[model samples]
Target: MEAEDFAGAAERKAPHGDRGGEAPRTLPREQLIGRLTQLAGVGNIEEAMRCLSEYVGASRFMLARYDLLQEQGLNFIVTSNWPFDLVRKISGVLADRYSRSTELEKCIALLQPSFEDLPPECRVPPGMSQRYCSLLFCVGRVRFALLLLFPDHMILSQERLREAALLAAYGASFVEGRSQRNDRDFELTEREVECLFWIAEGKTSDEIAVILGISRNTINNYITSVMRKTATKTRSEAIAYAVRNNLV
Candidate 1:
């Protein structure tokens, strides 16, 4: 689905409250599960995201591809209902953080929800929180992060947040699965993709050899094969190509 379809879909007025505006009414666990189940059958990523946002009392949602965060432009963004300006400002920060994180840290972070304060210069909407929530999940080999905005000082349910993340992952699998099936031009092997992932994480051939429990020369061979298949002359270029195309 196109990003424009849901870019501003979550900008509706909030419920009236003493503190300017109230948090969106959160869905109970059972109801949330029911809503997500129905959304799964509908196969609409935007709606599923909106449902999860509201179910967790969030005001806005931006679903982005974690792997492509380091790439230039907004191609990393899968779908978002966050403001265009805010997205542009925050994406660079997220990319920088992703680049600094180890590969193991990223894997352990999957399906976990974390919070971060917005950049000081960002102009948050009235009654919205300065801190935002982010949850990561994987669909096959690809990883995605769901960034959320909620009302100021609003306490969100941990259980619901985790549940929402899983449902979001489930919803995304359908969309991404279909896309992968139709686009098979890369045809990189699993081992080759593994090498690309490590190299992207800044691992040298010798380091990757130890990590994968293979010979250094074997690791070099895998790198060579990846470069050849991806038509990249250097290791950096191959990793760049892999990041851009979400091959790793």
Candidate 2:
């Protein structure tokens, strides 16, 4: 059940549709599952991430919490092996894109994996992955991302990355209490929170008003207040703020 015990415990399936590495070092599927089942009990995120890193053949990785409303800011970065300058260069670009993306798109992309080439200034070792395989996950209303850097030119199984994403999310829950230490002084009322909850669920303002037994104008006012309190410029941004802070 200890995190240390999981190191080198999970078997890896190489890219190209076949195994080519020293297969003896890979841990079996059953053991991997059993270890994941015990993930919640493993309290240190770095140790947990290291365990996952070994399985993926990742040279390094970064686990961070993102607020889609912010142009550039991580609520907290649980752990990362990324070089400092590299993080500084990429963070703003990443946040801006996240902030600009529509709510519908953000919802659809949740827990879905993506791969992107690293910035030219950021170079990895020859055998390291040139592309970053990123995955976003949510807990309550907060969103987190795991950017795992595996080996280069090798086609990693998406199925395996998905499992790592799930496991990393579970492990990160214990880190910083999953953004619980963030600001909660928004003073959103029960009604406002209810509207935000429904809004995040894809409800139209009119639809929410009807469900909450209120006028459309009232629903609009609640959302407007939320935007003001969160310093967001739009309704979509307000909802994104709620999601980032786990308020919804």
Report the number of the highest-lDDT candidate.
1
Tens-digit per-residue lDDT, 1-248, candidate 2: 22122121224444211224532244565666556446545555676776676555566788776654343354456678877777776687677677677867877877666777777788675677556767788765667777777654444555666677777776666553534524653488889888888886668998998899999999999988877877889877877777666675
Which digits, one per residue and each the tens of the lDDT, describe model 1 over residues 1-248? 22222122233343211134455556666776677667755667788889888877788999998888887799988888898999999999999999889888998888777878889999888888888888999987788999998776555555566777898998887776555321333577888989998887678999999999999999999989988877889998997787656565
Q: lDDT for every model?
A: 0.78, 0.66
Model 1 spans with C-alpha error above 4 angstroms: 1-43, 181-187, 240-246
Clashes of each: 0, 2
State every prediction's TM-score relative to the real structure.
0.79, 0.65
The true-versus-predicted C-alpha distance at residue 71 of model 1, in Å, is: 1.3
Show where candidate 2 strays beyond 4 Å. 1-20, 23-26, 33-42, 68-76, 174-191, 194-217, 220-248
